[model samples]
Target: MWALRRAYNPLKRRGFCIGTSRACGAKSELGSCHLDEKASVGEAAQVIADRSLSLKRFYSTTGDSSKFFMGRRSFSSQAGAKSSGEVDDDLEDGFSELESPASAEAILESNAEDENEDELISEPEPSEGDDEDAAVEEPQNELELSDTETDVTEKRSPRKGVPSALFKAIVAAPGLSVHNVLDKWVEEGNDLTRAEISLAMLNLRKRRMYGRALQLSEWLESTKRLDFVERDYASRLDLIAKIRGLHTAEKYIEKIPKSLRGEVIYRTLLANCVSINNVKKAEEVFNKMKDLEFSITPFACNQLLLLYKRFDKKKIADVLLLMEKENVKPSLFTYRILIDTKGQSNDITGMDQIVETMKAEGIEPDINTQAVLAKHYVAGGLKEKAEAVLKEMEGGNLNGNRWACQALLPLYAGLGKADEVGRVWKVCESNPRFDECMAAIEAWGKLNKIEAAEAVFDRMLKTAKKLSSKHYSALLKVYINHKMLVKGKDLVKRMADSGCKIGPLTWDALVKLYVEAGELEKADSILQKAVQQSQMRPMFCSYMVIMDQYTNRGDIHNSEKMFHRMRQAGYMSRLRPFQSLIQAYINAKAPAYGIRERMKADNVFPNKALAGQLAQVDAFRRTAVSDLLD
Candidate 1:
């Protein structure tokens, strides 16, 4: 329907894949007005300003708020990895979806990696002082525990900058309140600066120390030694969403000073919604953003684009139409998303046209583009075209473009070019990055070169200081595909011996490995253990594995259990589990009674294939012999 609408739109003359059949309209107290092709960005912005007239009167601009609009857009463009919810849930749920991955907490908690590790980062103490307005004097009272502070780092704060030493002390003093830690630093005569505090939090965030990062933010807000900016509030709001949940984050928004709440803040909420794959919530937030008269940035648009790209692609045109109306420029991320969307529909011609338009806009395609292009080309069986793109990517000095090398390994392997994988990997082998090593292992595994994959894994173990569970999962994937259950188990042990944190990926790997070994019960048992042990819920993929196995055997009870467990784990937005449940019912030749009602509740509409099957099953709905006897 979106594509059809796009066809008749006036923008058809521009040859864009995106268009609006109706004139773009904005709502404001002044009344509705149509934005046409003649509408300049300046005019659109003026309309936005007028729309927010009431809020503007209450909270005047300091100019920084504008940065969040343009700044977030510019930043997202360069974040090729954010394309991953193409995977962070990247591009974690990257730029963490590409973790190859919130709600904000979902993405943040995910960005933080495995919830068990999150337990290491101290939750900020609930204090009257935590209310940004309240400034109680005694730090000890603010953190009212019988303070036998067990220092994580086991070192005293050195006589350095308070912010700098504070970072070190917090790392050393996990489980201790950050407010207390800051109190200790202040007592030792160290002064603090906002920049230093910002830098330290950046480090914590970079290392996935979201718990610690969150604690620091709370302490900063309580201290009130520094002024709070819109960005500061936005950052704290996002951290809360990450460590806490969206509900908590939403509550915190009201607590923020009215002037400090704006697009950046709501954008954070929208991103978390997208990360969670909540079509309903995300749309609510996006509409809320518009109603509040915020100029929709590419970050916001891209988040929506990413969301639709995953769940409801028909809505992407609506978003693009909104962007065009808003005069919001498309970033490389935007173009990349559009290209992928077209490719996903197998529209080769449409895809290339977008690429040409992107080039005409003077935006040079990067490694991520080539990677996506190769994938689409290969999927369309354009082997020669895919290879040509790969060749161009490999052109000139491969040494400068390490991204191309990383993208190449997997791309080459997909084409069954084992030798080409080797050639690119040989370049990486000289001084290996962790990701390159991961890619190399995956490539060899795809080629069924198990020994080579093992050698790469071994090299990583020796050279990479310490590897995370994800690193081990790469090799584990190879073993699982080859049905080498023994090796997979051995790798899990090695992971534990290395003191690696077991996250969803490891749990998924273990499930697949066991299931592939014809030990369905073991896989089910493993999922149970994961539910019990992991602070991070096991991925729905693991549940699907066990569910699929049970469905195959017509073990309806077990399949239903898996389905219920998946919803309990907060993975209800996806349709895959629902399909698995229905398939199980079908295999059992029983009507999937009340399934349509359940689907409606969950907002999952069956496609034509599923709908037809559901109709068949619904017609056969009857009380079974066992139920009648009962």
Candidate 2:
């Protein structure tokens, strides 16, 4: 028996134990005692049961369970004494111990009972090496546990209007293919409502991510998820034109089914055309609407009316007559346009009749109507009537109406009523908008009250969080008008430092300052630098300033150079630049007849006033040459 114990001692170190009774009696003599396989199986079962209890105690004691389960699984596999089902059951018991409220002492007491029964099993205790391994692995286990807890918490918490998980998926979708994201979202058993898609599209549009918005709209349409209405289609079309160009918008419109081309879509396109001054396209759309028998709203008619008002006054009258023939009721905007047209033509009786007609139609005159009357009254030299109109507006709810106050300030300033300008300023100073502040500054500038203008400007800077280039330009003009050269230079420097994009107006004001201060070369240099640096095309005023300066100084070469640059820059659409050059040539005593030829080549015919000036210049040139010959 001692010899048998000595030979099997090596297997004992590997956790293989023989039952004491069986080993001493049956296996006392190696050949005489036969070992029972059933007894060995029973002994292995006892070893596994002892291991399971030790794991439970370890888990309960430390309240850290990963090590115990891992150790048990490894022990079972190495021993080959437990089935997978038994291992799984043991794992479940480990988990149950963790969830249970049994204290360390209670678990230890339960483990103590089994300790005596499994004495022959020799339950394993953790070694020094195992403790060190566990110490090293503790932090990693803690980190994984924390990460899992965070994921659970995030899933439990509510998100904003957008689901955080879905938003993250969408944002990350672009990194992958957008289609892949869409497919994954659909596969996740999630569905987006039409309103949700529309809101997402609008959010993208506001961020100027027009391409993304277009893509989302297309996706929604392709999936047959959204039944887009007329307004939605119109909005999409407008967005297409804004992001892509007019030509692309035209292509997109062509692709639209004829069934979807309704009045609203045409009206939206017509409005865009009007904004870009696309007269031919606007006419085509108007005619298309007429041919389609789309009920032409007054808004549509007014678009054409306003377009014609810019170039052909006769066409405006024709539009109104067509509207009457079509039986399209004129809106309040239509009546306002008529009043303004009559006012511009200086037909006061015509304006009054329109007002009466409006009132008879139950349309009370709005501020716009009163503004037109006041403007025409001022134009016709009826300042008293303009003042009465303003006083009447004041009697109504005029407070917080900064626009009316702005219009009145300029009229009072133009009439040289300094006291009235001050009164208007007092009424408008509270809650003044940017345009109102600008109007007040201009009025004070006209009244030659530089201090008052500066005060308004100072107040504007203090109250407003930001001022645009236009605001700075207006202030620069005030500084130049008052001959504050140092202050104007400082303003320019401050504008540059503050990173406000230097606009044409700012450049024009700065150049005017230099010209007023008798620095012609500096003015020209500044103008050139501004033209070079500005992303926008230089304004006609920028060119006119330097051209006038050079021509006045009899520098005809420089004047002609500047004029050619203006033409090359495609800014000669208006007649003002041509008039400036012709006047310059006449003043310089240079033969100015060629100016009329150039104007003709540019297809710019002289108006009555320009023709008279050209004729006078021609006569003066011939007379001077005839006298020299004599």
Candidate 3:
């Protein structure tokens, strides 16, 4: 029983009760080394009884207790091993009685059974010091026993193995990507192995958690686990997405595998940057490409040239000089971008340089570029210099966009050069896009050449496009300026018939014309209709029109009533209407009008002011006829 107890303890620690005590001793160290201090006493006792019974039965039946290692540790040896097999049966019965989750009782019961079943069954041929060996084993077993047992297995079983616990926690991460989990664990100082982390990262990447994969890859790089190939590809992808300028793009060119740094990649990235207005980044990429001995596209060079000229012409010139020194060939488009930007910035100095560069390149500056340059010249009041560019464009094979004609037409119109205007108009007529004809018409009107202006208007109608309010307004104002009332009314009617929105200016013009021509009824009808149409009228203009209509018709009472209404509506001041009231009073000459006459006249048309002085002079002249009458 004691021997059985010795073998059973190790078996309980290993989670298996396989054989007799001595037989179990061969694998005892492998099993016992893993046991902790928290194993359960009941489990330990059960293990003890089971191992002891198995050991005793096998040893007694085989008559070889050497393999079992029981020796004197059990009562079979101490009481008498009269028959080893019979003693084994007794030990088995003892084990069944003591194996009720208690080790000590099972040992004692096995001892009593051995003593009771002392009859010999089978005799073993002793080839060794069997009695002494048994005695030594018993004392050792007794010394190893403790007074109190602990259920260490119960307390420690939950946390038994490190590998199993770690795996459980990792797998139970609620479908979390393994790469993310590894990164979190590493970040948290969880001591997860690198191989484990790498495996997790790979798993996550395979699941298409690309963002998470990139994070882990970055972490791997930060941690210095990143290999050459991954680092190269990742850097290239990132650079293509973010870096813009030629200088920056050039810098990345070297990092790219030799096979990938072709014109397509280079030009594509450069063009994208230019379009998106990322010029600085594009410049950096371009510079980087230079170090790699790669050639840039003409378009890229042109875009860069334009960017430089637009933002800082002087700086760009310096860059161009530097590039020239480096033997970089500038394309014609490069000169064109230069011309365009210089013209846009009104940089005359840059424009001269652009012309010089175009000459050096043996390339004719396109008409659009030349037109912009000419327009700048015109703005500076240098018309002759602008004409020179236009003249040069005529002789050269300039691609004729509407730009030059548009610029030149206005310039000629401003100078009142009708011949030049006609010439520009002809060019404008050739191209459908140019609005030069409209501009020429406006200029003629501005110069007070209403006849020529009307001629231009008739030409615009031939274009078959609907007449715009702007065109109508221009012509309307021209007619009004000439006091051509009939023509002005016709223009307004034409504007309305064409569904053109009449503005306040147009309405004011028409109203003033009618009132000036003494067409009071016509002016009044127009005003009422305008007001009903909800057309916003200038308050002063409306009041003036109404007053003009009443005054022209000699309707003093109606005029006075309108005056009061205007004042009440906050549109007219009492002071403004005082003169008209005084005039009306003087004209009527009714009862009590004599004493109030001079006073009323002075109040509105004071002799100290223009209206007053005029009224006082008229009064003096009229009264002068009645000299000495009083």
Per-model CA lDDT versus the true structure: 0.60, 0.53, 0.43
Top model by TM-score, which number?
1
Question: Candidate 1, after superposition: displacement of residue 206 in Å?
Answer: 1.8
Q: Residues 1-630, candidate 1, lDDT per residue (tens digit)?
A: 233224322243332223212422222112333233233233223322222111111111232222212211111111111121121122112111112210111222222211121111211222111211111111010110011142212212352113355577777764557678877888898867865676576445434456777788888788786687776787787667666777998999999999878776787777666655566677668667766778767767777776767654544555666566566777776777777777776777777777777777787776667667777888889999899888888777787776567678877888999988998998999788776787788789889999998999899888866776656767887888889998889888988887776666677788888999999999999889878975666665677778888988877899999989988887775566766677778788887788888987875655444554576569444557647877
TM per prediction: 0.74, 0.56, 0.29
lDDT of 1: 0.60
Worst ten-residue run, lDDT, model 2? 137-146
Query: Where's the lowest-lDDT run of ten residues in candidate 3?
Result: 137-146
Task: Give per-candidate clash totals.
Answer: 46, 0, 42
Give me candidate 2's TM-score against the actual structure. 0.56
Better model by lDDT: candidate 2 vs candidate 3: 2
Over 4 Å off in model 3, which ranges?
A: 1-261, 284-293, 336-350, 396-407, 411-419, 427-630
